[model samples]
Target: MNTQATPSPQFYLTAPAVCPYLPGEMERKVFTHLVGPRAAEMNDLLTQGGFRRSQNIAYRPACESCRACISVRILVNEFKPARTMRRVLAANSDIVGTMHPAQPSTEQFSLFRRYLDDRHQKGGMSDMSALDYAIMVEDTHVNTRIIEYRKRVPGAGIGDQPKGELMAVALSDLMSDGLSMVYSFFNPLLDRRSLGTFMILDHINRTRTLGLPHVYLGYWVKGSEKMHYKTRYQPQEHLTPRGWERYAEDGGV
Candidate 1:
């Protein structure tokens, strides 16, 4: 009979670094490795506790003086697309996303490079090589998936695979309670299509279809312009000192 007890995860704190979302501020993170047979279970628990996964590590903000980085998750069943969101969906009607195992491809890397060059040329990931990108997608210990978004080819049968131009890709972790979006990128040329917002809407729909209750959207930093979009998705819950509570734009509740 197996009677050995499982080892608990050891957490580590990252050194303070310049805040990416806010100016004149520093950010720190508390993290732990997610590996072995309990990886998936640990991921779900850690995520529900407000941690965000990157590769095999689960981390959350450990800033000393700031609590602006609030974890946000959409209430999938109660989500109602606003007119603007509905417009985004209609704009991306021709694009379809297909889920596959978390495997990287040359084509995806190419698109990723373009996205970084155009949108995040000065960001930390700007210098990531193809190998680095592959590791990001494939080095997961939990249930991860890569969803490829492409334009639907005309006359394509239901069984036919999408062969049109790749528009975007999403790397996500499927948790027991919800889907956690780890990373996503899109073709910069299609900026007018608002592919980023479309991807989030798609994930919300996917979560609903899977009978999941939430679509984890990672952190929404207050005062961060880059994070403003996350707040557009109404009826979401934000992790607070009290716990996950419904967020009211009017500042009630």
Candidate 2:
């Protein structure tokens, strides 16, 4: 028998930086590397404990003075789209997402660049190069997938890949109990499509189909207008000091 022991993951804390979601606030993160043969199992545990994966790292907010970043996960089995959400789904009925192994390509990078240029021009990821994008999508150790969204073809079957202009992309992790949305971007010009909301709704459905119970939606800052959309998916659980608890829009359990 082999007499080897797995090394424990070493955790680290990042220095403070300007907060991306809140103004005049600084942010810090506590993180650990997710690698080795146990990566997938570790990811499931860390994600359940409110950490989010980026490449090979699993990190959570470690801000000194702020607690606005709350981890949110939707109850896939219980999710019911609101009228507006249904409208978004109907608007994007022509769009279909196909999951594929995590691989980087020039086409994805080009769309990523356009998305950053139009929607996140001043954001932290705006300056990411093609190499950076590749590393972001390809440097993971856990079970990950790249879901490419395109317009559905007239004769395409459910299992066939759609052939049309690439409309959106979601980099997601398949966890033990849920799907974690690592990142996603879409064509900013298609503003009316509401592709962002559509993608989340699709993930919920996907999770349900996979027999999973949750769709992890990363952090949702209370006052951040950019994050407010995450709250629209009701019956989600918020990570608290006590543990995951059901969140209500009216501020009650």
Candidate 3:
């Protein structure tokens, strides 16, 4: 057998589709398959350049005349939870998130199904089956983990594991410089708990505890109410033509 190195990654642009974030606009994406031995390194590089990962694909928006999807990353060391955020944390103090190896299970799928049904009933992922969910959770070559949030159960001892009702889950990657949140879902019934905001706050705290500089929140689309919440995390940086810069409220994208 002859020894040879693998070829460099080749990217492809997706066909334009109706924009989901903005009305009457089209959206395109530049995507590449993340596989092979260098997948982790390639993922890190692409992500730092403003790409987001979904399962085995790494992609970034390529919409012409539309720069709405801006990459947002929080400065973990400098971040301080706002008053509301503090309240969200206090509200969920009875809950805790434990990091577990990226794995799939029936319990996780049940929560995921419920979240999708309640939050994104018409979204593309609403119909994802359990097997598809497994691929999403386990098909990875990078350093990733699932942060499972649930009502805190009194533990037996220091070495014992937490046993709580599954309420939320976040799939994230630990990068050399930061933590990239791939995806997150929470119990829709817990409206008062504000689990969504609490999850982001927890990620920021986790990033700080890990000595990481940033916590990536994926793409924040301007003009989309769904993405506006990302701006709540103060002192965030947005990737621009001049590279990552301090985000200003006036910044449209």
Candidate 4:
């Protein structure tokens, strides 16, 4: 057996706050800062333990008396597209996503602004400016990348990569076992494309291409309509008191 030493990271708990997903419920988090040389390894460990990254912070739900938030990740190798998902893939065939080092751009911020305005006007990130957006994308020590989606030009030939108008963006983490979707946004005008679902689908395909077995989709809360879509990806695993196990489709909240 090979032996390697890694420093232990300190953890903290946040004060309880109003639950964003479930009404009439309070939510709290146990979080740790991801920094220094071992940030990447620490991040991977925490993520596998059900923590999610936001900029340089890794956090997981630590609510009192509530176990509604379940960490979910897709089993990519075992996934099969449903009829509706296939249709979504075909509908977005004209779009392409290019992965790049995590960096902020005016175009990306513009789309992010529109998406926030249209979908989450009164949410926590509504007041974020361009600089804050930049920090969100770049202030990280772990392996992070952004995938920018755009529509292909009419005359563009095969193997010709072009960066057109930005349509959607996914901020993802390349972990040891899978790609974790930290956050994502899309052009509000292209709701017809269902860019949200398309982004997840694209990540699944990307994971397959990379020979990764899973795609981390973050947490799913029971009784939250906003989180219901996450359960659509079948053969997924959820972190439990025992450990990660296959999620039951009919598993009640």
Candidate 5:
């Protein structure tokens, strides 16, 4: 006894290009635009279907003969911290993250510039200007937010919140199942913070606090060092042809 109308989504495939994660390998993607009045609802469905949103575009791997880009999500309640992850948490104890509207800021762009210059100097987005960065943050049709991380300012009291110069930023999407971290960057000079891992751990904790199920990490390429960290979030599931299947720790079928 249910009557409802579901919106239809149109899909497109991108031309093959060099894979960012795996060198020499080609990458192709099946993508669709997330727009119109039903954008949020459509986003929820697309995410569940293994697509990740970037700005207003939702995309997933569509390689000719490779399936390495597996969509992953941590089962938050079941995630237990490993020894190394505990160390990372301890290392970043002085950093506090504040979630805000997805509106971009000049300070964030400055941090973004430093990060790109230090880390991804030769990557595709290396040439992006402040305007491009702003569009990446603000050009969205679905529910999105930005989490700003900063050093905890020395509070003269115990209960006071931290307020310091911006150290990192993560543009995230609010999905029904969990939050999807669209993109993130930090002050590359602060390499000691292990900010990348710290952010993921923080998001996992945030999801748990929100009583959500998973944190949809975009993709994990098996042999990619940059993506290998994603596998450490145990009790995670991967999107396979069958469905979201639990990842085997032994790296087997």
Candidate 6:
């Protein structure tokens, strides 16, 4: 006859592994499951505290002495798209991103596989199967959506429009502060379009349309060229030990 609620879940840490973003360094993770009735609230707090979501789990870097991975979010209202970003917006003017429920599809997996093979073949998820990709997309316990971008089909570009083949996909979490882009990948062949930059610009516009103030871009490793593209989004705030500090090419005060 013990009608008591179960105790809240506790956090756990994982052993160190070779850091992906940096060489000659190891990385560990302090993580917890985002589950149950309180999961949404839990997720929000952890994300604000600089944790990134993966499936139903939330994790943050627990490196012993390194602080390379700093979380970043665009200052949406303050963000003035640079000349290059303006070109990206124009380049993708024919593409439309439709947000859908967090459900997996074979088409998505196909694009994901091509992306991994072309771009991140040596990364951790190189071996992820379709099932793993599905879990990544559908195992969320909080508000999540998949934004699939494709060419605007002729005659149906507006209003309940059906689309063309998928060009890119972003798995995003709807947070109280902003939209956290969990993961995104596109056809690598579209390098000229700079689909990666286009996606971020698209998200910034989407956030503005939703009246949101920021668009979370996850960690920006200090010395990684692959991560440098994130800094191009001007007027971004970097989560530092002193807290979220706004920065420009001249650095923040």
C-alpha root-mean-square deviation, each candidate: 3.1, 3.2, 2.9, 4.0, 4.1, 3.0
Candidate 5 has which clashing residue pairs, if any?
Answer: none
For residue 136, give model 5's deviation from the true position in Å: 0.3
Candidate 5: regions farther than 4 A off: 1-6, 156-161
- Which candidate wins on TM-score? 1
- Residue 81: error of model 3 in Å? 0.7
What's the TM-score of each model vs. the native? 0.96, 0.95, 0.94, 0.95, 0.93, 0.94
- In model 5, where is the ten-residue run with the lowest total lDDT? 1-10
Report the C-alpha lDDT of model 1 over 164-196, residue by residue, as the tens digit: 999899999999988999999999998789999
Model 6, range 1-253, lDDT digits (tens) per residue? 2312225757788999999888899999998888777787778888888899999888999999898998888999988888988998899888889899999999999999999999888888999999999999999889999999998887873686556979999999887877889999999899989888998888898898899898999898888988988888888888888888887746642
TM-score of 2: 0.95
Clashes of 2: 0
**Which pairs clash in the backbone of model 2?**
none
Q: How many clashing pairs in candidate 4?
A: 0
lDDT per residue, candidate 5, 1-253, as tens digits? 1112226777778999988888788999998888888889898988988988988888889999788888888899999889988999999888889899999989999999999999899999999999999999999988899999988887635466557879889999988989998999998888887899999999999999999999999888888887888888898999888999998667842
State the TM-score for model 6: 0.94
Global fold similarity of model 5 (TM-score): 0.93
CA lDDT, every model vs. true structure = 0.93, 0.93, 0.89, 0.91, 0.88, 0.87
